[model samples]
Target: MTAAGYITDVDYIPGFYPQLAPVAMRHVAALNGVVPPRIADGFRYLELGCGLGRSLTTLAAANPQGTFVGVDVNPEHTAATQRDITAGGLANTRVITSDFASLPADLGEFEFITLHGVWSWVAPEVREQILAAAQRHLAPGGLLLVSYNSMPGWAHLQPIRGIIRQYAVLRQGDSAQRVREALAYLLFIRERHAKYFEDNPRAAAYVDGIVKQDVRYIAHEYLNEHWTSFYFAEVAGMFSRAGLSFVGSLPVHTNFWDLCVRPEFQELFRTTTDRLITEAHKDFCANTAFRWDLYARAPRAMKSFEERVREADDIEFRVTRAGVTLPHQTNLDVVTSTVQGPLYQALLDMMSTGSRPLSAIVADPRVAGTPPADVSRAVDAGVALGLFEISARHVDTATGEPRGPYAMPNDFNRAVIASDALSGRAVAVASQLTGTGHTLGDLDAGILNELVERGEDGLAPRVGARLTAAGRSLERDGKPIKDQTEQGVIMAQACEAFCRTSLRQFLQLGIVSPG
Candidate 1:
């Protein structure tokens, strides 16, 4: 380990990231004209700095055949994850407390190696060790995902972080308490309208976001001694030295050049044949603060439009759990536009039943007359617009009041559902069929937890009781619903919606099973 140990004073929060899933990574790779590791024969997975192993264990439950390992320097994080692994019966995963420099040689190679919160927060020497580990353990043709706080986006926020860290040093208390003090200091400065905050409304607004984050997250984020942001070209150069080349990016949408930049920036992408230049330009246009980049040790490049389409045939897509209507519109950070018309409608109609491979989608008669490239473009835009996903099952977009039939949720999901309300966090539940975690609302999880414990009888009231115990305000029109009758009515309504929509969807995703 580096002389400066990670902030052991506060344990890092566990997380479940769907983008790191093998199925999702493969989908992103295939979209960007690179062949991804095949998922059919099972694969080995590793996570560096897997805080609390939430994602690692959840994924182990989701993909039972895959071997999983997580390494973290903090014993608290590893020990917590071990509890979940045992609780969830996730025997496929193993957690070790070790830094990147001296990882066990016998740990062997992995088809997928990922590090999310580690890269930008560690020292230069540590980053070099990370690359060394990746080069040593990433199998040829395997993919490695590295997510870091990116440049340009973090550029303005750097000063805020620096001040917070400096102020934190003088403050007295544990890490979380110091974080609270530092944030109080930052907010006090911002409230006075510091010249920096006054000049940058975005940075000012960012402080409010920090205020809302979990204190633990704030501590790890702002208190890290080596926290640094990198430009795309520089990070790419570092990865190149490891014999790995860039495959693609995450959120899936970022891979689509046109979707990544606004209209005026379209010409820049069309003019640039080199992908590295294109990525750098996109970040500038979108002001990307963070990025999830995929690198492949032996990437098989797909150069032509036809070749990419042919390779993409094996890739599958589905209507996102949020569902889709053709004229889908969203106001996202990068760009926004309304998506509609025959191709999308055809795609939606085809995926209504379940996920379908691109080959089946294009060959379907509903979209037969459309060109293959057009179908690919629509899928890309749909994914970017938040209307689609690379998934294996379909659930109606969230609607209705939740009600239910109950067999217990999977052990992994039950662990999440059982604890989420109390944890003040709603980590997504694992879905075996999708090889991903399905997002669950807090109220819905509470209701599900109630149903599991007490059955549907008086379920709504029990869920309300849990909510009340959690100090939740049962409100109406932004005011607390003061009448007992009105509160009961509101809980009943929410319960109905969850049962009809979210509960049914959970059934399909295998978050819950049929008794």
Candidate 2:
């Protein structure tokens, strides 16, 4: 391997994107709402470390109107991405191989930027260069998406990292080869020190699981020359240094102070007058895989009201009580009350059914006969009412489109369900209650019921659905949600999460028309 030991080869990972644009666009579009100013004209997107251009490809395909540029230092990834762009016949996207400091002058400014998997793996200098480039290229009101390894969440990996680094240094050249050798040696050490596993089953299980992981992820993640994890405060500070401001998370549900962890914990951390504690808790929850930050060129600080509004805008849709439907109208007094057509009237007719998704309700005879065009029109009208939400159908980069409208990747699902506190219990109950892997509605009911029983009022079905989807995505992305990879366990957990969030979101917005 070269001294720097970057993974320079393409892994032929055609379907490796963490999230797909369909779902993302739904959320982001809903976040943008009707505000044309917050949504940039001639919006340009820039991606740092565009591996094989998978993400950019998805983004370009989904947002045909937008332009995207991706840059990476790895020639293999760049070449493969270029090939994909050509084959896909994408005119809106371009990819180049260059260091952050050597960006092409004609690239122009971007209204949205994403650097996933590059920030924490590079030297501090490169990180700064990337931030500098982001600040320079980003348009005012533009969004920056940065994902990285994070502290406290990744604290357990530090010891493993130290061991890998130590072993890697002993081997000459061939970083992948060195990683393999080191892993073997570590296994030998673990076997000899079986007593360690005896006392700490969880840690031992983690080690065993790591041993079985794809060697590429193992080699690059653990043996890399520069792998740094950050705290929320540090990340915030870095972006601030680069003249960017903290907006929220890409998974909009994640950034909300109301969604993460236990309510007590969140209340303590998020509302704390103490900034450090709040940041520490954020680091603990996110493990720093995804970040959604917003920046403007003029540097006038966003007002608290403006930030809150923007945060709400950036979110796909919030799950809220049925009574609170059309909040932007009743509370904020934003959307017009004028009805558009019979389809719109039909949608409102279904809302009395207590938060059933428009997709589900449309299958019923009352709406099934509606033309696709009319259905879409009705859906958009509800979007105007703040009654019906438009969530993107989940897409997989591995496959052109999901065979179905949704994917319930169970293995990944279980890991996420297992990781949470209340969600875990809700998942367990929902699985038992449904006698199968949980669906969006099942877990949504389970969690809201639990929360209500625990005296938390104002429970909404859409809230649970939104959270569930976020949890499931994390699982399917190979982030390991459950402790064990037992049959169906992971899948159940992930679906449970997806169900909760999706249902919550549908319910929160009037997206669900009642039968």
Candidate 3:
């Protein structure tokens, strides 16, 4: 570790990121008509800079068939991860404490390698080592997912980062304290109407948002000694040296041209036949701040239109929100649009029942006349809008059996819910269906924890007691219930909603069983 001890600091918070899940990565690849590596059976998955290893541990628990390895420089992070793995009784995951530059040569190849929030935060030499690892260990057709702050979008915020870092270095305090001081300084300057803030008005909003973010996150993001933002073409060129070709973005929306770029720029984008140039132009148009890019060692041949539609048809989707109303609005930070049409409404209606495969949905009489490609596009749009979640077909390929409500309780979810209860801090819950973690709020975690301890027969009273202990009471029509009878009624209603919506979602995620 260096004298500053910054590189090996363990001050970072543990959190789960669903974007790094194999299901999510594979889904994005499939959206581009590329078959991702087989993760259903034995597959190697590695995450570099896996801080606290929360994401990898959750993935390992959800995906017992795959081997998961997380490497980080901080011994504290790796040790904490090992503790989590042991607690969870996970046999398929391990964490190693080693810097990227010194990664063991015999670590072997991986079907999927991810570097989340690390690419733009490390030194050039470290980045070179990461690429070398990818070059040596990324299996052919394997996906390399990397997320970083990108240029054009981050251009305005660069100066703020610089100012914060400079101020932090001169301040006499620990990382968190320095971060607070730095943010206060920035706010002081902004309030005083500094010339920098005057010229970059949007940057002020960025700083305001940053101030409200987790202090630890702000410290890691701004207090880092080395941070660089790149354009899509620039990062693409760097990966090209490692024989990796850009596949697609993890966010499915970016794959669709209409969703990413404006109408006027579409013609200009069409004129440019180069993929890199088109992406660069799109970045400028959308002001892309962060990117979750997927790269493959070798590009898969594009599937024919019929083949693509056939493959797409097998993927499953479920509505994420309840009681969704149309003129459905989708917000891509850069742009927001209302999706209003009979096709969208019909698709939403279909998903309201439960998880449905795209094939069955397209076969519905309401959309029977719609072409498969058009249906695929509509589904893609819906997913991008957060109206639906797409699960890769391979997630259920091994069973090859019709999936109904969960029949067997998921031990992983049970352990996770129990751990959350003991820790009194709820972050996320493991989702077996999607092979990822779903965000869990405190109340949901409390309710689920109570459900785990007391079965449905004893659920309501215990849950209500738990809520009452937490100073949360059942609400009816947005008003808190004080009367005992009304409280009972409202609690019953809340429990029903939990069973219908939250528990149903857990079932879909294979977190719990109908039994």
Candidate 4:
């Protein structure tokens, strides 16, 4: 085993987390009444243990103004990330292969630092090194995002982890093979009506969920000897040692009191402005199993309401898709409520047409007279509830034309399109418009490649050829279409949808362009 007690032989998956985007981090901070790194001047970003660099490379490509760096102990991870950086021709991002304690001294400070799966899966010593890195390098007012498995929810499942890990050690081969054996043994036990599974149905169901996950993921998740899930208060206490204060959690709604817990349990939070207490209480109510939490090295609360409004102006929001009606009622996990009203209707109306700055949406004549703060809250609520989305303005608000220099479907995007078309990995291509990755399914990727090769022509030929070569069959309604005419009709329908929906959106996001 590695000295750090991490899973090193099997590499982690390539995944992009939208919350790690610089624009998203800035918005979450501002939404919670904190001043973030100024957007106009740009900022530096770092991801400790950045597995495969999907999030890192995509964000760097999406945000030209921001410089990005990724550090991971795994050389394979760094090598793959660097391959994308070079092939995608991203000059704004770099990756370093080094464990946390031995990070290069020349590496400068970062305005944003994030660690997604690292916190709960490393040795205590490695965690100390992580904190040491943050204490030494996090710039003033910089945000640090740490996502990990949390307690209460994982409490019942702790025995489940132990059983798998124990089973793994008794078997042979590498982490992956061992995990497969362990998973099989556990499933065998559950199927035999073991007392533990019989007593805890949720845990039994959780085992079922585990078996369906990727073997690579299961290996890395459970095989690590240092796996530890933490309670919120305990985690906060540790970050405090590194001079970081927990500000708010992600999905935006977590920061709001009314949106955090059940309506009946809401009384439990009314007496506390202390986030530590509220977070613990909120966790118990919702039994939140995992969290994407934001913390700042130097917590800087906005000094005035005007400053908060100014922050909102730079952040933009829009309906997630065209014709999205505001839900008459909203549910934020355990918290459910009736949010329909004049302001909500006005919000839906204004954003339905295009992405607009929070200031602009709240200032519209329809939503006017509503307090800007209240309006901003509503916008955040919609985002949390999946009613709206956050984006970068790709057009001149006044001129109704493209604004920023459009360079998407670049060398990097081409490689992604080619890979995703065949792999069906659901990985995203970089987007300048959203300042994040835009993901498409296998068929959409095929359609995009066709558009890249030859636009507005017959579809089923090239796309279907790619599928057949990849050993995949073209299917409709879960049944393979062997007949050419039927396949042509289905492909035609898919072509219409790609153009009407995803293609149009991709054009706005600059993920693809006219060759």
Model 3, position 255, has a per-residue lDDT of: 76
lDDT, candidate 2, equals 0.52
- For each candidate in the order shown, give its overall lDDT on alpha carbons: 0.81, 0.52, 0.78, 0.81
Backbone clash pairs for candidate 3 read none
Clashes of 2: 43
lDDT of 1 by residue, 248-343 (tens): 898877888767789988897777778788999989999899999999998888776577656545456778754556577876676777877877
Q: In terms of lDDT, which candidate is stronger, 3 or 4?
A: 4
> How would you encode candidate 4's per-residue C-alpha lDDT over 1-515 as one tens digit per residue?
13387878898888888888877888788878888887556789999999999899988888888899999999999999999898788899999999999989989899999999889989999999999999988998999999989988899999899999999989989999999999989999999999999999999999878988888889888889999999999889999999998878887788777777877878867677788888998899889889889989887898665787665466678777666554556767787766567787888878776788866776699976888777877888888777778876542112233222223456778876766676756768887777777777878888777777765555667777777788876686767889977776777788778777776677666675534
lDDT score, candidate 1: 0.81
Model 4: runs farther than 4 Å from truth? 1-3, 326-331, 394-408, 475-489
| Alpha-carbon TM-score of each model against the true structure | 0.93, 0.57, 0.86, 0.94
What lDDT score goes with residue 378 in model 4?
83
> Per-residue lDDT of 1-515 in model 3, one digit per residue for the tens?
32123444426777888889887887787777786776655789999999988899888877788999999888888898888888788888989888887777789999999999898888887888889999999999899999999988899889999999999889986888888899899999999999999998999877878987878888888777878899999899999999998888957788777888878778966677687987888898998999999998885754664665454444578776768889978877666778888998898888775667766777788888888778877887788778888664323211222233334265556666666642434567676566778877655776667765656675667777777776767666767778977777766776667766676666656666555
Highest TM-score model number: 4
Lowest-lDDT window of 10 residues in candidate 4? 396-405
